[model samples]
Target: MEVSPIWSSIVTAAGGLLTGLAGTSGPLWHQRRALARARHAAEHDTTTGLPNRRALTAAVTRTVRRATPFGLVMLDLDGFKAINDTFGHEAGNDLLAEVGTRLAHLGPPVVMAARLSGDEFALLVAGGSDEIAAAAHAAWRAVSHPPVRLGEQAVPLRASVGHTTATLGISPRNLLHQADTAMYQAKQTGGGVHGATEPGPVTDPPPGTRRRDLRHPH
Candidate 1:
């Protein structure tokens, strides 16, 4: 069979064009996917798949800017150091991940759950005092119940939670500090939920008075 040179050239050029488009688009697609992954990793805690402190700060800032009524709950796991020391950091990490899962699923009136740092987390709640208090108590029960099993060990979890409703003129830092202060107070009183007494702007804890220093020994 004989084919026209011009027709064959047209077909060959079309094939090359399609091949070139694929070669160009494939890397572009992969580059876009990589960028998305980087952005997600930047905003998320790798261990628990929850929003990190940076993301939580951004959320608080946005909420405050919009003048939305909301609440912040700060929670710190009790005796976390003892868990790390006894069962190893792996077990501790596993427990933290489990806690994150529980908090993330707390449902309604609870807007977002974030991991602030090691063994510490925050919940962004929406509503008035009653709603906020309900969410805080629910979070405490969710974290403490049923126990998390790491290998052959069934580990019990306990946390001190401090929650505060946002005020008219509260900065993001002050709001977080207020919640943290309440959490510290809860820790001081043997670990339970505590509400912030100061609804106005608050100061950071004094030097050497960090909450980590107040962690109860197991």
Candidate 2:
């Protein structure tokens, strides 16, 4: 069959153009995806898949710059070293992942959940003192109950939580320090929740206290 040279030329040109686009676009797409993955890895905890400390610091800085009232809660797992020693590092990793999942599900008021290092974690709550306190207690309940199951073993987790409310003009470092101090206070008296500005009493959850019966400050 005879074909027109003009139409044949147009068809050839179109095919070449389409092939060239695919060749370039494929690599460009892959490069973009790789960059996204790299960014995510940089900002996230490899063990628990939560935001790492660097990301948390950025969030705190942004919140402070906005002059908004918020709360920072720092929590350290009680006896995490023992867990790692007894169950092996794999189990410890599983437990940390479980805790991260629990905290992430705490929903609004808890703006962000981050894993700071080893068994330390932080929560950014969107409110003042009262809201922060409630969020802290809620976080305690989330990790404490429904023991994390690693293989055939059920591991009961306990955390010492300290939280502080922040307003305008507070440095992120100072805010984090306040929460860390409160967490240490809670840790000192076993494990429970404590507030930075509060004094005289700490809400200590008795060992083996049922989740429903655990009392927190009002």
Candidate 3:
């Protein structure tokens, strides 16, 4: 009957609408999840799961208040280019992940460990220079242990560290720059021991450095 056909068409239309709505919702849900993952990835290192430089800087700025003894450590993977050129970036990335794992085990005082970029990394420590030095030494020794498993081979990764710590007063950016300089000094010293400030030494702290107190926001 004509009436039956009309009813059938109406039912079919309703069904199609529901099906379309359901189908579209699934993809939308997936898309949202994917977007969240992408955002998370953007702020984190894929291999290490550690925060990148941008995130690290923000965290440092927020955490380094007037009362805390803050320190910064700059780390560079020694012989990283050799590994990447001789082996592959895959191997190099794996090595970085392994290093990150070791660093995480160091626990407190090391508030944050971030992969600045590439084979270079940095740590924000909630302590003075001495604490930073101890931690850097530990991290250095930790990385020097038996080679990591890479493509059926044991890949050795070593680190050179430099640290600048301020218990009373130092800006996070300046602390990092000084720490970077210190790490360079360590690299020049053949990558052993800890706490080398310009190795050849005898220069006084900059004119304004001695006057700054970390305990007060300058």
- Choose 1 or 2, whichever is better by lDDT: 1
Candidate 2 structure lDDT: 0.87
TM-score to true structure, per model: 0.85, 0.82, 0.71
Off by over 4 Å in 3: 1-39, 193-218
Query: What is candidate 1's lDDT per residue for 71-119, written digit by digit as tens?
Result: 9999999888888899998888899899999999999999999999899
Error of 3 at 149 (Å): 1.9
lDDT of every model, 2 decimals: 0.88, 0.87, 0.75
- How do all the candidates rank in terms of lDDT, highest first? 1, 2, 3
Which is superior by TM-score, 1 or 3?
Answer: 1
Best by lDDT: 1
Clashes within 3 Å, all models in order: 0, 0, 5
Local lDDT at 184 for model 1: 84
Model 2 ranges off by over 4 Å: 1-19, 198-218
Greater-lDDT candidate between 1 and 3: 1
Which lDDT tens digits does candidate 3 get at residues 18-78? 9999999999999999999988887888889998988888877776665677777778878
TM-score of 3: 0.71
